[model samples]
Target: MQISSNEIAWRGGKVVLVLPLPGVKQTPPDSPQLQALYAKLEGARSGGAAVAPRLPAADYHQCPRGTSVRWYCFYQNRDWNENVAGRRLQWSDPHCDEVMDFEVYSFAGQTSSWVNTGFLEVTVWDDSVHRLWTEAPNSLSAYVGSSNNDQARFFEACA
Candidate 1:
């Protein structure tokens, strides 16, 4: 398989990439974890938009360290809990538009639990955002999560 620098890992025959959302990299549909993230974003499934890639440090060169970013979190009872790809997100409010974050996953084989998926971060406003890292999200949170519960949940692990 062709590989590039963006590859975070290729565990258990499944690739775990961490690039920008809607990035040049493509997530193979066969990869459930990655594809599921792609499916979560609106217009991705119905409009055939490309899934966003994971966040890279270079993407935030000019952004400040404590800008405050946000991301999406979605849980389904005891089944699975997934997040919205970061690039697909947009500015929620002036207070929330400060920043956001991005990352990706592709769990396979024995990895069945939510935490086992190995991808979830807090990023902006609680009602609609969470700031995991102090780095500014730049353009990552331009348009992504909404107030929709099943569709979205925003929180930050660290501020």
Candidate 2:
């Protein structure tokens, strides 16, 4: 999906990762509601939802090396001690000297009062190759599958 610089900076988020994908091409969401209004919000089903931009194969392939592919959702709590279900991978690059960094977002970037307590599942994708840090879910993790994506370890404040 293509977006203007203004749109990206304002609403595209700090890290805009792909959820349902082929690492190149992703299938469309089944539900129109899920594809349209509901998924585009900030929270999960409550108030925060995010739209997984449908990028064409050609465009996806041409993406820059430093592009950030992010997935975000509402974390329904402030205090966290238990580990949630997730996957850990160390995304790497073979050609470039950069190591793709991944993070299970905390509440540090939620500066707006209008938006709910959201957590970002962020990771940097290089053009060459990628790697994983861990293999299973815990307090901080994320899965890398088309249907099993967005398995992060966070909660919303409303919980």
| TM-score of every candidate relative to the true structure | 0.18, 0.18
Candidate lDDT (C-alpha), each: 0.27, 0.25
**What does candidate 2's lDDT look like per residue over 81-148, in tens digits?**
11321111111112123322223433222211111112322332222223212221112322233322
Where does the lowest 10-residue lDDT sum fall in candidate 1? 108-117
| TM-score of candidate 1 to 2 decimals | 0.18
> Residue 116 of model 1: what lDDT?
12
Tens digits of per-residue lDDT for model 1, 17-129: 33333543332122344334333332232454544433446433211111122232222212221232211121112223333222223221111112211122334233235
Give per-residue lDDT, candidate 2, residue 10. 20
List candidate 2 segments past 4 Å from native.
Answer: 1-29, 38-54, 58-159
Compared with the true structure, the alpha-carbon lDDT of candidate 2 equals 0.25
